[model samples]
Target: MKDNPLIKTLFAGSQPPHLIDPLALFLLVLIPIGALPLSPSEEIHLFLARTSLLIYLGLRSIQGLIWTGRRNRSDGWVTSISWSSSLFLGIGWGFLSLSWSLSPFTSRSVFLDFFLYISVYGLMTQASLPGKTVKTLYQFLVMMALLVSLDGLSQKFYRYDAYLPYLTEHPEKFDPHTLEIMKNWITTFRRISAHFLLPSHLAGYLILIIPLNVALIQLTPTLWKRVSWLLVLGVNLLVLFFTESYGAWLSLLVVFAFVLLYPLVPRLRRLGRATLQEDSPGQTPGRLLKTIPGIILLSAGTFIVLTLIGYSRGTYLWDLNAPDHPGYLRFLNWKSAFLILRDYPWTGTGLGTFKIAYPPYMLPNSTEANFAHNSYLQIGSELGLPGLLMVCLAAITWFLKGLTTLSTLSDPEDRIIYRSLFAAGLGFCLHNFVDYDVYIPALGLTGFMLLGLGGSGNAEEGEPGRREEPSPLRPSPASPFFNIAWPACLLGLSLWLFILNGKLYLVNIHINQVKKEMEQGEFEKAYQIAQKALFYDPGNPSLQEISGVLLLQLKQPERAARAFQKAIELDPKVPRFHAYLGETYLLRGDLAGAYVETKKAVELFPLRTSYQKRLEEISSLLEKYAVKNRKP
Candidate 1:
């Protein structure tokens, strides 16, 4: 107990305040257990849970630093070695990403966050209580699953049945120009709640966890233990079906197949096999109870019936082929992503820059898309192949390491747990072939938590070779350095990211609301909200476009023209900027000037027949105006 730095720091130079052993156990086990019931929130207050967890980790890191200082003074080198390796890998990727990103600022920030996550893992590796940390994470995952399951249920049984009114009313804010984006979004999805942003994402999220849930049901020792996992599996699957995301369903099938086949691979022969005697026999009463696959069938049946009922009422099953299904355009987006990759393969357009840059390339006949549905393509287009390769390699390394561990572990329960997690990770990897969930910070954070769980040894039993016999040479489990520093650092970084993400979310929501207000003809409200948005994201060209359009509507053409020019300067590649500028020039009766600008617009977007028509109109007007002036 004295070897763990976190424990030592708390008790150092003071009498024991409480039973340290019990406290350590509680921290290791219960912190994760306590988090199982979270629901996706519209309220900002939910940020507290993340804040608390950060505080907990920060204290742990401090404990580790203090303990290490008192023990062997040479331990700093070990910390430095681990951090250095992580830093080198991270910086290498960051520089490579900078070379390709369309939005270098956003790319750099994401890479920084990615690097911090890697550092956390490295620090975790050096900690003495890795098993406990792992256990804490597993408990956290189980709880998260439970919460998602419950949230999905509420969305189905309560919301769908009652047709619940908007849960939270947002203030209106956005100019008429920006509100145009909302019209397309409103018709895209039937239900757009926090629980399920898009059908595919919901399906993908649940699919990722199916393998883990299955493992829990199969490998857990007691019949009760196995049965407990069924609730989570049942709920998650139910929600997945409700989502009706075909891509997610397809991804799940692929991942589940791989997981089921993983154990049968010849290379896995080294992983010891379970003896026939250990398998529960068919005859025992308790064993018969264990074979109640009937419960699973019933649960599934109930879900299907509920889904059918929901479908009858028009609240279920998103058909990708339906006329109203805007998602069908994803095929074009996918193609465009490849085209963009070909054009800028080395460095991407920039992180978050694809949406801003991709629309002009779309066939003039079709609707514009918000994203290239494929995450890998999106990342590849933004950061280039090297950045993509770096991320892929990191994920592969972590996954294979986890797989190797799972295969070698002796405990059936632990092995099952790992197999399930591996399945979820596999599902996400597959899903990313056609979706961008991996880039979502909230989802990414949860994924990293799961990744941490995958790296953990058995918490209750401790990791192999971690036994304490109390040698003067061997550090005590309670050593201050072993426990404190790493946890503290992790907590601090995690909190900072969470806060940053929360603020970002608020900005997105506010921006969306502002645009809606603009659409409703609330120009004053829209302008007010747009200004506020500008305050938060002054560099956003889209926001500037909105401000410029609104200024034009208010009869400030010169100022509006300047704003349009600025938008072009910010991103000259956008054809609309030229078109808008030409329109502004025409309004000012500068026929020659208008013709020049209009011709530029037509040249930039040849397929836009409207732009060509406008160009012809300007040319004719300029010619007539020149002839009339000569007559004078």
Candidate 2:
């Protein structure tokens, strides 16, 4: 080998390719960081987060378009189809976006939020996933989880009568009724929220991050790096526990089972078989990883041990029993949700409009409720079965595509990559089942990221599959059809946002009407106002709860109970719902039912002296009722 240093240097491949695209890297860091934890209650916080995501997505797409470089072979049909589908979906959701908006102001806010999700999807697709992007996202999720967990802990221990210290300090912004409902939370032990999103949402956020962390760990090289991932996971898991969000906890377990465990079935079959190894020069047979007969047993054993430790230590995993317990009000929420879903099986009241809409349909004699407590029912009652179906289809489609991509890949690394994506997707999907994390953009974005990972196609390693060769460099202006189509989609989306804004605004006005009427002791007028609000945004659970309260005030016990139940259904994790429903039962002279519900309210929120007092009063009433019944 003649040493011709200059010639050799000239021929040496242009400094090992920068695996990460700079634009993509910039975007990965900026978007999530821009959304960094803010006061959950602050509308500004949400607005900022939404803007950051949109900006990041725009930047990412431009980068992707530039990096991919316009090629002659670019499948115009495929690209058009994909973009068109996205546009249509966005338009549909945009229309939906207006359904539950509170006011012109709230409607505008909500429209922006809805549009943001569309932009996020477009941006995600545009910015093809790179290792650095994955790493950045992973780190963000981990940090967020940690912050939320820590905040949750602080909230619980510090007992904030005013505000969560790290978040916003605006009590004036909150609806007084909303404030009253959440007042009992001062007794909890963590800072899962600063009031913008609830503690349950904070917990759900952590659960969503865990899968991303797992994915990041799979990408790391060193054992220490892997262990660091474990640390992040552990911290998030611990914090999630403190949040007392059993729904999130259950969702996490479901994601683990669906993504990580289900894939293992095929792996177990290939367990003892030899496979090509990356380490061996020229692809040699690697040691066959064993598939133990007791793998299931081992998993079960590990789960058992963890469960024992968690239960003994009073971890969130065991907290689900709270809902199952006689004192926990989860059942009441479930009951209420079902009632709403059954009555409004189609064209739901409206998206995000459940609180106000569900009141008239609630169980009688109940206090006002603010949510459906259940994601499934809430969606069903708001957008109707079709809306629920649309969301479900979107979710399932994302998962199936991701799983398919992962299944066909042979490389262990690739498999892990896809698996991690699947796991992350599973986490969000599961989390949605119990807690409606979808309402919060930050959490929803995280979910969509996992979906994006699933939808994305990865480049093959080793004998690379015939790469989708880059298209020929050309300045292909938008086709006339495309120009028209793009504008049309934008116009449609705008129109929908406008309608949603109007609907939401009207609903808010109607809600305010009810509030004022209630203050004036005009229960019938309040009830009427609530009904009008439902006509505008039938899914407003707050309105529904208020309506139910008004009915109770009007001495309509059955109707009031029904309304409270509906509120619980729209949002089950909120403990006050049980108290409201229990009171309704008491007013109806159903002492036994009152005792049961009040007990549940007390259990879910031990800090609520109001709930405790109700429970005690109900218990005494029940005793007297029992004695009287026996004597009769």
lDDT of each: 0.56, 0.56
Candidate 1 local accuracy as lDDT?
Answer: 0.56
Please list the residue runs of candidate 2 whose C-alpha ends up more than 4 Å from where it truly belongs after superposition: 1-29, 52-111, 153-183, 188-196, 264-344, 364-369, 458-479, 491-632
Q: What stretches of model 1 exceed 4 Å from their correct place?
A: 1-92, 95-101, 104-194, 215-229, 268-332, 360-367, 457-538, 574-583, 590-632
Tell me the TM-score of model 2: 0.60
Worst 10 residues of 1 by lDDT: 13-22
How well is each residue in 138-251 modelled by candidate 2, as lDDT tens digits?
676577666666665566566475454322333434555555545544433333453345667676667667777777777788999889888877777766655555566566
Q: Please provide, for model 1 over 1-632, each residue's C-alpha lDDT reduced to its tens digit, 9 standing for 90 to 100.
A: 12343334453522111112324434433332332224434233223434444454455445545545555422331343233343335435555665555555455456544544443344333334433343444455555666776776676556553323232222233223223433322333333222544456556556656665676567556888767778778777777666656567667756655554454443543332322223345344454464345445544664565456346434433564554343556677877887877887776676656765575566544555556888777766776676567667766666556555655656554455556656666676677777776565445444554455454433334232122322335543434553455445545655665555555556566667666776677776776787787777665566677778877777777977887887777667667788888888888877777777777776656666788899888888888888888954
